[model samples]
Target: MVLIRRMLAFLMLASLSASVPAFAHKDHDRKQHAAEAMHNSAHQEGAPAASRMHQEPMHGAMEMEHSADEPPLTFTDRLLSWIGRLHPIIVHFPLAFFPAALFTATIGRRRASFATPVQFLVVAGGALAPLSALLGWLDAIGMDPDPLLTVHRWLGTMIGALGAALAVWAWRKPDQDRSGLMMAALTVLTAAIVVQGWFGGALVHGVDHMNW
Candidate 1:
């Protein structure tokens, strides 16, 4: 049963992460519109010589701004961007692990043998959650900021903190959670994951992401 559960969880994670690209596709249109607007604004009604004079300095300033926006295409920038891209990939692990841990912890409350697996999942999930959050921060560097993005950022950070704390709590009180504190914490962790997922989806797919 445990093996089957683990296999199913892996499959779910794989499917979820694989669909991230599709969710992000809408952003491309928004980006294109913004680019077009910038281009159009750069050309304004005026005398030809006056417009050229105005554009020259503006063009130079825009170049400088673009350079500041993204680091030079050096090895370090490339490597960080590559790792940052892995945010989409790595995020699924904790998404799977914490929920699995919640399940195991709940079941393990009655069956003590299941505690070990819960601990394992919690520790693994807890560690990776922060790494995933860090990668997300790096990846968001050039992203357009919005309310959804702000909420996702803070919520993701909290999830990482809660996951890590849950791991430590489970470790420190390996056999004394009969009061169901760990179970409750795990439940809250799972809830946070769900809410964070929605915010993330909304950021990529817009406010109507869940509209049927």
Candidate 2:
């Protein structure tokens, strides 16, 4: 249990240190892109109105052509893109851990000796949950906004938070018996995971992912 807690603490620190700068840099890039877009819009507005109207189609085509001719991604960019693609793979860890914790805890309620294992699962889940969420955000940072994506992102975030909370609850009361409140929280976490999993699948497989 001590080892699990230490690992989680380490992960928290690493995530903070790594994410802050990466996100800051991404934000800077976004602001720069937005400013450039706005400047181009302003330039178009300053053009003769009739000419602007006549040139709109050509302007869009030219932008597309320019994008097509843009240089390929640099090595670093390609590596980052490959890393971003790992989100789906990494997400399975927490997806299994939280539910597995709930299951272990449920069984542990009957057998007192299962407490240690329950604690282990909770801490493991908590540690990986945030990492999964971070990877998801990085992967989707440049994706087109959509309702399903929005729901999946926020719900996945909420589940990660809940996983962390569950770990803390278990750590603080390591030997304490599971109370009604803890059971209820576990139930809610499980349900949230189910819903979040649906949304995640829908994001990848379309809304009919669970049509059956």
Candidate 3:
């Protein structure tokens, strides 16, 4: 009876010892799984912040590239800009002379005395037209392209061409007012100048400048 009791006690002790190792292994596995979960969660939480940190420098680099694209203005560019500014001042000469030529040319048709003044006005206006157009082109440098700009540019070009043609005609002819062709050309040029003035006013003021 004593031997049986000792055997039973030894079996119980072995079973208990085996169960302790399994319980310890389960606890270790649970701890390992929890540690892995914490690491994964931390990484996920930091990912967006790390991504933003990386993007900030990239954005700054893009801005630097954009800024570096434009070179510094040279002396020639500055000189040209200065010359271009003269466009506004020089433009008034042609503006006054062309319309005055039209008036004189019309009146000169009746009186030979007015012919000299008509020829003078035409020559002065014609000579200044090309210079004004050139200066205006320079003034418009680097301006953004738009509908009004297109119309203004082409209109100025046409006026310059017409002015040159009229000047050459007057130079060859004895009396421009007597010639029907010269009178018609003068009328057309005057009309164009008037239209140009309106566009220029629109540019200075607003599209609604004519409303009043």
Best by lDDT: 3
- For lDDT, candidate 1 versus 3, the one ahead is 3
Pairs that collide, model 2: none
Candidate number of the best TM-score: 3
In order, candidate lDDTs are: 0.84, 0.83, 0.86
How many residue pairs clash in each candidate at the backbone level?
0, 0, 0
How large is the C-alpha RMSD of every model relative to the true structure?
12.1, 19.2, 33.3
lDDT of model 2, residue 29: 100
For residues 11-120, could you state the per-residue lDDT of candidate 2 as single tens digits? 99999999999999999999999999989987887667668798899999999999999898788877767777888888888888777877887877878788888888
Error of 3 at 107 (Å): 1.8
TM-score of each: 0.64, 0.64, 0.66
- Compute the lDDT for candidate 1: 0.84
How far does residue 79 in candidate 1 sit from its true spot (Å)? 2.4
Off by over 4 Å in 2: 1-67, 71-79
In what order do the candidates fall by TM-score, top score first? 3, 1, 2
